[model samples]
Target: MMADDGGCGRCCFSFVLTSGLSALFLWLSLRTYKPSLFIQDLYVPGLNSRNNHTIFFQLTLRNQMKDKGVGYANISLSFLYNSTLLVANHTLPAFYQGHAKTAHRKDSVNAAALPWPPSNGTVSFRVRAATRVRSKIMLWFTKSHALVVAADVEVGASGEKVKKKSIKLKSGVADPGSRWLRMGVANAMLFAVFIF
Candidate 1:
């Protein structure tokens, strides 16, 4: 009886171990990450009082996932002067981006909408972008998720962004639903730990 009991205990331990590893693998394989966005470059000649009436910019979109793909809908971009005055608008074509890929979009926009010239050899601007993203897992795609991100741009006497490094755009506000979902995930992870 003692020998049989030892064998049974070993079998149970192996079963639990296999189950835990399988769960971990599934969690890792199915995880998703939202793509990252950044303002790679910005040049506003109007800010420098150059009478150029043009804005040149470079935008960077990155999909950092190692295995999954990202599909973006038409991306709407807007530039606001002094955080309120609309200065320019543009739409970027939608496309599928592969994992670990980065896309750079460059454009020159007419800055006829500038309300006024900058003061003190400096200016403030807001860059906003909105898009819908879908995650491609295996052969299937997930439902579209709305993403809105914005960044503040400070232009100096040179009429270019004050920051030399790329400025990462971030979601301006968090919705209640996503906050609750994150909390729920944390709780579920704790429960799983207790079970294991």
Candidate 2:
């Protein structure tokens, strides 16, 4: 009977230990936030012409983590025509975004002075924004993240309606060096648990 009781106690202890470690790993995975950029709106203010024109738009930065915020190091915007012609470039001011919050900034790109004029009937161009960000969790841990947001739009002649298209650029999350460390720690813990 004593041997049976000892075996039961060990089983209970192992179950509780596994449960606790699993919970910790799950919480850590769910609590971290990934930064994202969005182009909310883009439109031309006046008629398209050979002369210079300004493109007006709103850009939104989002922080979805409930406990973490992001600090921007640099944000840049560029406009391209036919994927090769550079139309305009602008550097936006840096700003901080709070947890579960979003910030919007209004900016314009002047493309009128392009050396190559827009093709006569319809003109299509791409707008892209790239940003470098630092995310902080509880003021103790920080990681760097980078992302790009882009969209394409085509404008018809003076009387034609503009059809805006989805952004075709593909980007991935920028995981900081600490992210690898965290992953390694998690993997080690998992291996140790399973081995023992």
Candidate 3:
């Protein structure tokens, strides 16, 4: 019985030591890991100038971290109409926007999400995001004026600095009256067909 007791004690000691070593290794690995975030594709869709429509754009962000990340993501969008600055806030419905750290990616510390930008750049850098940033913008047609739209966004990680780039975009919506006229003609044709 005494020998058996001694053997069990040794086994327990080895188990505890192994557990401690494993924990230490994990801590070191996490500390040495550097998180990375970058932007993917960003562009605006085409629009007809004669159809009182809105211009829309999209952006993609990507997170290149092996482990999960815990941090905040702040994205800003600037819109321009014919070289005029439109919405300047980065937030929703404004020029300012931000997301909490709780919003992560794939159960990891990283987050690859999409947030809309206020404006797109014509020649500058595009909006930066994680591994996948898919954002959309809507520019309403208000007049029969020739306009140029541009947008840009800056992105950074927790320990990294923020970077900026302009996104060049060219789009125009058509006038509302023309759209109405076309719709009316289409409706008239349909009505005539139905009558016949």
Candidate 4:
């Protein structure tokens, strides 16, 4: 009876240790990161002119993950004037990006009702982008996650971005998927702790 009890205890310990290690690995593999976005160039042709109030923009999105890929759903871009008025909008089609891949999108939209610039010789605008992202692990893709980002842009009288450097867009609010990931990590850690 004593030998049998000792053997059962050893088996339980081995199972618990294995479970803890598996949980730790699962937590690590489930982590996800957001892709980086930058506004490479923004140009307004003949700023608010009658013939051409068109807004042209160049956007660069990079997937910096080393071991994972990113797939983007339809991305909606909105251009706002004075942060209050909508000047133009466009939709980018869905696409897939491999790890460390960079993608550039150049598009133009008509902003017929854009207002004139003030004495600052600069126009203030905001660009907002919304899209769903799927994280691709080794063999399967995670569920679609929502991501929203925006950037403040300043255009000079020359109808070009005031800054020559790329401007990064930041999300005003955290994505639900990110929150879920955090929760998942926390739970996994707790489970591992209990097992150990």
> 67-93, model 4: which lDDT tens digit per residue?
899999999999998777887889999
The candidate maximizing TM-score is 4
For model 2 the local lDDT of residue 47 reads 46
Q: Give the better candidate number (2 or 3) by lDDT.
A: 2
Give the least accurate 10-residue stretch of model 4, judged by summed lDDT: 112-121
Winner by lDDT: 4
Tell me model 2's lDDT, rounded to 2 decimals.
0.66
Model 4: per-residue Cα lDDT at residue 164: 96
Model 3 lDDT tens row, 72-187: 22334443333333422232221211221122221111112223233232222332221112111122211222222233433222211133342333324343335655665676
Which rank order by lDDT, best down to worst? 4, 1, 2, 3
In model 2, the runs with Cα more than 4 Å from the true position are: 1-23, 26-31, 45-47, 115-120, 156-190
Off-target runs (Cα >4 Å) in candidate 4 are 1-15, 48-50, 118-120, 176-178, 188-196
lDDT of 2 by residue, 66-166 (tens): 77778887788887764567777888998888878988888877764654334446566677778777776666546556767666656555512264432
Q: Which residue pairs in candidate 2 collide?
A: 52-112, 53-112
TM-scores vs. true structure, each candidate: 0.79, 0.70, 0.26, 0.83
Q: Residue 98 CA error for candidate 2 (Å)?
A: 1.0
Each prediction's Cα RMSD? 3.7, 4.4, 26.6, 2.9
